[model samples]
Target: MPKVIFHKHGQVFEDEVKPETNLVVRAGIKQFPYPNLRYECGMGKCSKCACKVLAGAEHLPPPNWKEKKQLGERIDQGFRLACQIWLTHDIELCQEEITA
Candidate 1:
């Protein structure tokens, strides 16, 4: 298991998650301390789960086709679909910090 630190509202929601756990599942398991989390297809087609990867982007699994497509031209901006982010190590993530 890897610890995930989700930063929101200037606070951190830390939780231990399985390596294969995706952000949406983790969020749901821990309940939403984070935001902008919605699911329609649950297969990463919809971008409702879009999140900004403020840090630890390298600690997650590589982007899948669905995420790549949904993120489109924002991949370089650290935009990633939460449903597609598979945790690989302890990671710190934040949405608001993306623009900072």
Candidate 2:
């Protein structure tokens, strides 16, 4: 069980994320910010799921080809495809820092 903290609207939401959880899906379920805007394409086509990795990158799976292609060189930065992430440790998300 890993904790996922979401900082949004001047409020902090902390929850434990189960294995194989999709960030976008979880955000949508938790209604973080504008869930609709956060999760547009279930597939990797849409960049809606993209977000800045505040922490836990070491605990997250490496970006797949799709994510790499979508993120381009930004992948080298903190940007990551939230929908493709499978939590291995605690992670934090912030709407203000979202890249896509």
**Predicted structure with the largest TM-score when compared to the true one:** 2
Worst-scoring 10-residue span by lDDT in model 2: 30-39
Candidate 1 local lDDT, 1-100, one digit each (tens): 8787776666767777777777787456655433444444557877766767777888777788988888888787887887776777877766553342
Q: How many backbone clashes does candidate 1 have?
A: 0
Q: Write the per-residue lDDT of candidate 2 for residues 1-100, one digit (tens) a residue.
A: 8888876666777778676677777656665334433567757887667777777778777889889989899789877877777777788875554545
Model 1: weakest 10-residue lDDT segment is: 32-41
* Candidate 1 Cα errors over 4 Å, as ranges: 28-39, 96-100
TM-scores for the candidates: 0.73, 0.76
lDDT of each: 0.70, 0.71
Best by lDDT: 2
